[model samples]
Every structure is written in structure tokens, then in C-alpha cells.
Target: MTFTDDLKKENEDIFQMIFDHPFVQGIGKGELPKEAVEHYIKADFEFLNAFIQVYSLALSKSVNREDMAYFHEQIQFTLYDEVKPHLNFSEYIGVRFEDLQGHPLPPSGDHYIKHMLYHANMGTLAETLGALLPCPWTYLEIGQKLINKYQPTKEHPFYKWMHFYAESGKETEEMRKRLDVLAANSPVDEQNRIKDAFRKSCQLELAFWEMSLTCETWSGELAVIK
Candidate 1:
């Protein structure tokens, strides 16, 4: 079995937790509170900026032209395709882009982005892939499952969101190929590091969902100035 497959099997418990998380179930049921969805979109917007940077770091670290091209393409897609659409959705949901601009990152988002950036900037390519894989891969997995189970209509609140990741889309296929390459070529010594990064990332995915469900924010109260 491939390394990615093995990692998924070993971490099935965490994956199941993420799939069963209230936030995800809410999305599936078309019952997620607007406030919680707003919170999640805002947090995700902040994380995507950092995510783009991680892809850039991967591009810089790429040894071959093909890898560089792929990473660059991913960076573009995250910024233009993913982030832009989410901003539009935010406006649709009554949360302005301005509202998201200065709000502090939720603790879960902060930690997850920091962990991914640390690995993307400082770790080997295989480790970087491990750090990056969970976001898209897990979303795709959840999307497919939700679509199958819910058979949501076009009017469903999260129809577009679920459709975005529902299938083995172009980006998803590209990511799978990248993972296969990494699994085949990465050094034996780095196996443990890769697995650890993947597992921790899956755990963080769960935390992120919980944070959204609870509308978690920074710990201290905000001062009001009039």
C-alpha cells in the first residue's frame, strides 16, 4: 500500500471524528447556523492567505520545473478560485470582507496555519506535502460523503460549497498525483516525520471544525472605543 493510504488507515479514527463533527454534519443537513458558517468562512479566509504562502514555499523548494509549475498553479487556484469565491459568499451571508479583515484569527486557525507554515517552510518536500494534503483531501472526502447521503437540492444552503469539493476535481486529481510521487520517492528516514505531520494535521482539522461550531475567538475581551 502507498504511504498516503497507510496514513489514512492508521488515522481513520481522527478522520471519522472530523466527518462526524457537528460543523460538518450541519453542512450535510443544511442546518448549520449562519453565525457558525460566518465564523468558519472568516477563519478560513485568514488561513487561505497563509496557505498560499505555504504553496509558494513549496514552489521555491521544488527541484524540478514540473513541480514548480504545479505549485504555482495551486497558489493561483487558492487565491483566485477558492479565496475569492469565499469572499463573495461572505457578502452573501451578510459578513463583509471588512469584518473579517481585522478580527484576530481564532486560536484553532492560528495554530493550524502555524503548524502548516512551519513544515512547509522548514521541512522536506514530503513533510510539506503531508502538511498540505489534509485540507483538500479531507474536504473532498467530506463533500463526496455529504452529497451521497444528503442528495441536497440546488437550493440547499451549502450546495455550492459541497459541490466545490465533491468529486475528484482537477485540483484533487493533481494533489493525488503529487502525493503518489512523494510517497514513492521520499526518503525512508522521513517516513515517521511525514506520518506525524499528516496525523497532526488531521487532528487540527477536527479542532478547526469544533472552533467554528462554537464560534471560538481570541481569549480576551475586545475594548470598545466610541
Candidate 2:
């Protein structure tokens, strides 16, 4: 099996937990509250903004033309295409995507971005992919699972959201293939770090869904601090 396949096999338990989460289940069933869905739009907007920043930083760090091009493509896709579903969803719900910009992510959302930025700032390109790959992988997996269970049509409330993720993206495929190649070429020690990073990212992806579903935010002094 490929390296990504191995990572998924080992992370299967986390994947199951994510699938079992009420937030994910509700999305699949189209039973989520608009408040919850709106919360997701705002958080994800902030999340992907951070994503573009990471890719921009990565692009700067790339030593080779190929790597630079890869990062550039990722940035473009994220800005223009990856966010399309969010925009579409917001419109369907009468929320302006522009209005959601600059909204602060809940703690877990910030933590997830900080996790990736830590790798992006401190690690090699291959190590950084470990942190980045799971975002797409987990979302694609969630989409596929929901599609299989619900067989959602265009009439589905979240058909666009579900279809967008379920269909995955070129960047997702590129990330997996690039990581596999990097893993094949890297030493054993680096491979372990990659595995650890991938696992942590998967766990964070699960947390993000829960955060969105519950509209979780800081409370008391912590809430006031922001």
C-alpha cells in the first residue's frame, strides 16, 4: 500500500470517531441547525484564510520550481475553488461571505491552524505536508461516507457542500501523491514525524466539526480576552 494508505489504516479509529460525531451525522442527515451551519461558514472562512497564508509561506520556502509551482497551485485553488462551496452555502442561507471574513475562529480552530503553521514554520516541506494532508483527507472521507449513507440529490439542503467535499479536489490528490513520493524518499526518522503529524491533524479535523456543531466559543474571561 501507499504511504497515505498506511496512515489511514493506522488512523482508522479516529476516522470512525469523526464519522460518529453528531455534527457530521447531522450534516449527512440535513438536520443541523442554521445557526450551526452559519457558525461553520464563519469558522471555515477564517480557517481557509489561514490556509492561504500557510501556502504562501510554503511557496516562499520552496527550493525547487516544482515545489514552488505545487504550492502556488494550492494557493490558487484554495482561494478561488476550495472556497466556492462556502460561498455558495452562505448565499443559500442569506449570509454574505464577505461579512464573515476576519471573524475569529474558536480556540480549536485557531489551534488547528497554529498546528499547521508550527510545521510550516519549523519543518521541512515533507513534514509540513503531514500537517496539511489530513485536512483534505478527512473532509473527503466525510463527504464520501455521507454520500453513501444518504444518497443526497441536488435537493439535499447541503448537496453542494456534501458534493464539493465528496468530489474532493485536484489539490487533495496532489497532496497525497506528493506526500507518498516524499515518504518513499525520506529516511525512517522523518517518516515517523510525518505519521505523527498526520494523526494529530486528523484529530483536529474532528474537533473542528464539533466546534462548528456546538457553536463553541470561549466563555467568561477567556471569551472576553478576545
Candidate 3:
């Protein structure tokens, strides 16, 4: 099996937790509270902006044109393909998508972005991919599973959301294949770091769902605000 497949194999437990996460279950069931959904969409907008920044950092760090092109394409993918769902959902809730752009990320979202940026700032391209790949990878996995299990239809409240991720599975598979090549070429020490990065990101993925399910926010207050 490929390195990406092995990383996934060792994290089967986390993947299962994410799949069974109540927030995700709620999405599939079309029973998540509207208020929680609103919070999540807004937080997702913040997360996406940070996500693009990390990709930009990765693009800057690329060693060759192929890697550079890959990161560049990923940046565009997040902007267009990923942002569409956020736009559609914001409109559904009567909020301007632009207005959601600068909202404060909830606690888990903040930690998640920080984790991605940490690798992008300090680690090699392999480590960055390890940090970055899981976001889309897990979503693609979840999307495909939901589509297969639920056979979502127009009547489903989040059909568009689920369908978008499911359809994007092809693209996400390409991403994992790319990461696998990169990981296979990296040094042993770097590979270990990459594994840690990948696992932490997987854990964070579950926390993000928990955050959304609870509509998590700043507890007390911040002196200066975003």
C-alpha cells in the first residue's frame, strides 16, 4: 500500500470518530440546528481564508515547477470549488458571503489553522502536505460515504453540500496520490514529522465538527477584536 494509505490505516479510529461525529450525523440527517449551521458556515469562511494562506506559503516553498503548479492549483481550488458551498449556504441564511469573510474563527478553527500554518512556516513541503491533505481527504471520504449511505437527494437539506464534496472526491484522490509521492521521497526523520502532522490534523478534524455542533465561541472576551 502507498504511504498515504498507510497513514490512513493507522488512523482508522480517528476516521471512524469523525464519521460518527454527531455534527456530521446531524448534517446527514438534516436535523442540525439552523443556528449551529450558521455559526459553522461563518467559521468555515475564516478557515478557508487561512487555508489559502498556508497554500500560498507552500507555493512559495516549492522546489520545482510541478510542486509550484500543484500548490497554485490548490489555492484556486479552495477559492472557487470550496468557496461555492460557503457562498450558497450564506445566501440560504440571508447573510452576505462577503460579510462572513472576516468573522472570528471559533476555538477549534483557530487551532486548526494555526496547526496548518505552523507546518507551512517551519516544515518541509512533505510536512505541509501532511498538514494540508487531511482537510480535503477526510471531507472527500465523508462525502463519498454519505452519498453511498444516504443517496442524498434534492429534498435533503444539505444535499448540495454533501454532493459537492462527493463529486470532489476524484480531485481529492489526486491530492493524496501527490502527497504519497512526496512522502515516499522524503527522509526518515521528515517522514516521522509528517506522520505526526497528519495525525494531529485528523484529530483536529474531529474537533472542528465538535466545535460546529456546539457552536463554539470565545468564552470570556478578547480585549482587541478581529
Candidate 4:
């Protein structure tokens, strides 16, 4: 089995928890609260902005022309295809792009992005890829499962989001191939670091879902006085 496969096998329990999480189940059932979804959009926008920088860092670290081109293409996709639709959706849900841009990152989202950036900037390309893998990989996994069980209609709130990852587009395949190549070339000692990054990223993914589900924020204004 490849490192990706091994990582998945090792974290099967977390994967199951993520799939069964209320946030994911709500998407499948088309019953996720708009407020919760809005909160997620805000936090996700922050993550995406940071993710673009991670991609830039990856591009800088790439030695192969093919890898460079691939990272460039992904950056374009994230900026144009991925983020644009989310921005439009946010507007549809009565959220202005400026507001989302101005919103502070929640603790979970902040930690996840920081982790990705740290590895992307300081670690090897393999580790960067490992840190980056869980977002798309897990989404694709959940998207396929949800799409299989739920045939979303036009009115379904998450239909577009579901389809985005469910289709497993060219970009997703490119990412998987890049990860495979990195894993194959990496030394046995480095493989452990890559796997560690992958596992932690998966854990962060779950935290992100929890953050969205609970609409966690940094504000202390709502604290109750004893």
C-alpha cells in the first residue's frame, strides 16, 4: 500500500467520525443550518486565503518543471474556480465578501492554516504535500459518499458544494499523483514525518468541522458572569 493508503488505514476511525459528524450528515440530508453554513464560509474563506500562500510556497520548493506547472495550475484553480464560487455563495447567503474577509479566523481554522503553512514553508515538498492532502482527499471521500446516498435537487443547499468534490476533477487527480511521487521518492525516515503531517492534518480537518458545527468564535462578549 502507498503511504496515502497507509495513512487512511491508520486513521480509519477518525475518517469514520468525520463522515458521521453532524456537519457532514447535515450536508447529506440538506438540513444544515444556514447560520452554521455561513459561519463555515467565513472561516473557510480565511483558510483558502492562507492555502493559496501555501501553494505559492510549494511552487517555490518544486524542483521539477511538471511539479511547478501543477502547483501553478492548482493556485489558479483555488483562486478562480474554488474561491469564486464560494464568494458567490456567501453573497447568496447575505454575506458580503468584505465581511468574510474582515472576520477573524476561529481557533480551529487558525491552527489548521498555521500547520499547513509551517510545513509548506519549513518542511520538504513531501511534507508540504502531506500536510495539504487531507483537505481534498477527505472532501472527495465524503463527497462521493454523500452523492451516492443523496441525490441533491436544485433546491438543495449544499448541491454545488457536494458536486465540487464529488466529481474528483483533474486538479484532485493531479494532487494525488504528486503525493504518490513525493512518497515514492522520500526516504524511510522522511516517510514518518510525512505520515505524521498527514495524520495531524486529518485531525485538524475534524476540528474544522467541529468549529463550523458549533459556530465557534474568538469573542468573549457572550461569556456568562457567575
Candidate 5:
């Protein structure tokens, strides 16, 4: 198998584990107790908020470099093609970013936006690959579980959104392939930069989750204060 194939396969394995985990199973089936759903929602919100900030930071650091330029383009395409088109209202509700202040998104919606930006700024192709892998993986796994477990009506926003993301399985696989090629062609130093950035991104995600779990409540709109 190609390197990308191997990488995707490994990701799938982990995803499967997550999917089967008791917590995921509960959430997917819409059987999460009120307490569990509350916890999950809060944690997810915080993760997305910080994630977007990291992306913006990466973009700022990218400056005028050629390789970084390409990375930016690829990320933009991915967002346009995959994410923007499939964002569910409930997903947005978790993140209350200023961009949607009038709409009042969830507590953690902005953070999710920042995470996407983070993937765009990863220095090396490999680093980008590591960062980007989670998007398709998380969505695909979650969508499938929701489809199997949840009985949402056609009018439910999440049902339609999840269907769109879930059906893009081929596109997700293609992205992984492209990332592998990008990694192979990137300079060694650039790859290292990507790797470092990926690690930082992961740390940010973890911390965000930790905060969300610890903070029982955050009042006002989740949007950042200017």
C-alpha cells in the first residue's frame, strides 16, 4: 500500500476505536445522559475556538514563503469544498464566535474556526498532514455513528450536514493522498516546522478541552472580547 494509504488506514483504526468507545456510542445513539452531553458539548466548543487561533497564527507566520503559499491554497480549497458547505447549525451553536454574534453560536464555535486556520499554517507537508487528518477523520466517524444511532428527521440540520460530510469519504481519502505527496516534496526543515506546529496544535486542543471540562459555566456570548 502507498504511504498515504497506510496512514489513512492507521487513522481509520484509531477512529474505529473512538467510535466504539462507550462515550462515543452513547453520544452517537443520542442516549448520552444530560450530564454527559453537557460535558461533551462544552469541551468540543472550547477545542474549536483555540484551534482557529492557531491557524491564524500559522498564516501570519507563513508570510511570503512559496511553500507556505501552496499550503494556504490547499487549505482554502479544503475549507471551501468540505467544511463551509457542510457546517451544521448545532455545530455552530457550540462555538459562539464574534463572526456569528448576532446568531449566537454554541459556546465553542469560534475555536473550531481557528483550528481550520491552524491546519493551513503547518510548516511541513507532513505537519499539515498530521493536523488535517483529524477533520475528515472526526467528521466521517461521527457522521456514521450519528446516522446509525440517531433518528433525526429530514428537517434536522445535523442530519443533512452529517450526510454531506459522511458521503465525502472519497474526497477525504484524496486529501490524505495529496498531503503525503506534499510532505515528500517539502524541504526537511520545512517538514520539521510542520511537525512542531502539529504538536503545538495538539497541545492547544488538549488544553482547550481541559478548560472546557473544568469550567462548569461561562456566561455571556462565547465570542472573544475585543
Candidate 6:
């Protein structure tokens, strides 16, 4: 199978797992009690804040200039423009990246974000953008699934929160055209470097979600203390 094919398969696997998982299903469909939904949202946001900040710093320190530029653009466009501006739910909780300064990322998190940044700076641009493909693509799939399952209207914060999934410019076919230009100009070695980066980045995302599943399991065994 092609690399993109494998990524789509991986995404399908995760979507199935999350969809079937009782906790996620409950939250997605608004079947979970209000308290449980609030609790899960807190945990999810905590992890995400830690994630984006470390990713930002890691990419900021990347060895390659152009890849670093990609990371910066991702931060500027996706995080600032699409995510932060669109998601009012994030603001209500005050769970921004700044809230997670000095927090230690899981080994999986470190490897995923840093590797992408490193590859972008040093590897091929297809690979650089490829490293980014997982976020928007996976998000797009899940957001569509959720909206199909439960129609979150404009009045609902859930609707606004899911905008990040559909709004990323990278998820468009236009990105492929842009990447094709780089692929033509790039050396063979650089091209392979990008392909490797893209593959590994997808694997990292799979692992991160797996970790979240584990976290959910462990947290569930604990007492619910409000």
C-alpha cells in the first residue's frame, strides 16, 4: 500500500477504536453525565496544551531552516488562526500552551513532534508537510464522523471546537500540488528523507492516541473526586 493508504488505514483503526470505546462514545453523543464530560474535557485539554507547546519549542529549535519555517507556519496558521480563534471552548477553560510551560512530554510525544521538526528542517518538504498530514487528516475524519453522528449546531460549543478539523489548509488537494513542486526540485535523498519523516510522524500520532486510551483506562479506575 502507498504511504497515504497506510495512514488512512491507521486513521480508520483509531476512529473505530474511539467510536467503540464507551467513554468516547458517551462524550461524543452527549450521553455522558455532565460531570464526566467536564472531567474528560479537562484531561484532554491538559494533554493537548502540553502537546502543542512542546511541539512548538521542538520545531522552533529544528536544525533545518525551511522545516523550521514550516513549523512556524503551522503554529501561526493552524494553532493561531484556525484552532485558537475558532474554539471558544478552549478559551473558557484557560488551557492554552502557555499553561504547560516546563511540563515533561511523554517519550512518545517528544519523539513525534521533534522528529517532524527535525525532518522538516533537514528532510524533504513533502516529508516536512507529510509530518503535518496526520493532524488535519485525522481530525477531518473524526470531526466528520462526530458531526454525522451528532449534529452540533452553531449554537453549540462542540460545533465550534470541531472547526479545527475541517479548517486546515493542508488537508486540501492544493497541498499536494504545492508539495509536488518541491518533490520535483528536491534531491532523491531529500525526497526519501521526507517520506521517512511522514511515515514516522503518522506512527507517532497512532502511539499518542494509544497513550490517551491507556490514560483513560488508568484514570477510570480512580475515584471521581470533584
Can you write out model 2's per-residue Cα lDDT over 1-226, one digit (the tens) per residue?
9998999899999999998999888878878767777778888988998888888877888889999998988888888887778866676667777776777889889999999998889887788999898888888888889999999988887788888998875658889898999899999999998998889999999999988877888765232111
Top-TM-score structure, candidate number: 3
User: How many angstroms is residue 117 displaced in model 1 relative to the true structure, after the best TM-score fit?
Assistant: 1.1
TM-score versus the correct structure, for each prediction:
0.91, 0.92, 0.92, 0.91, 0.52, 0.59
Q: Show where candidate 5 strays beyond 4 Å.
A: 58-125, 145-161, 167-174, 186-226
Candidate 6 clashes: the total is: 2
Residue 129 lDDT in candidate 1: 86
Candidate 1 whole-model C-alpha lDDT, 0 to 1: 0.82
Candidate 3, which ten residues in sequence have the lowest lDDT sum?
217-226
lDDT of 6 by residue, 90-205 (tens): 34444553442343444455566677666556654466666666556655656667777777677654566555555544544444454566666778776666566656655666
lDDT of 3 by residue, 147-174 (tens): 8888878988678888888778767787
Candidate 1 displacement at residue 146 in angstroms: 0.6
Poorest 10 consecutive residues by lDDT, candidate 4: 217-226
Q: Give all candidates' CA lDDT scores.
A: 0.82, 0.85, 0.84, 0.82, 0.50, 0.54
What TM-score quantifies how close candidate 2 is to the native fold? Answer: 0.92
Worst 10 residues of 5 by lDDT: 96-105
- Per-residue C-alpha lDDT of model 1 across residues 1-226, encoded as one tens digit per residue: 7677788899899989989998898888978677777777778888888899999998999999999999998988887778654754565567676666555678999999999999987798889888888888888889899999899998887778788778536776677667777768767778888888899999999999998888886778542211
CA displacement after TM-score superposition, residue 222 of candidate 5 (Å): 21
Error of 3 at 129 (Å): 0.2
Candidate of highest lDDT:
2
Residues 91-133, model 5: lDDT tens digits: 5344432233232234344444454455555343356556655
What pairs collide in candidate 2?
none
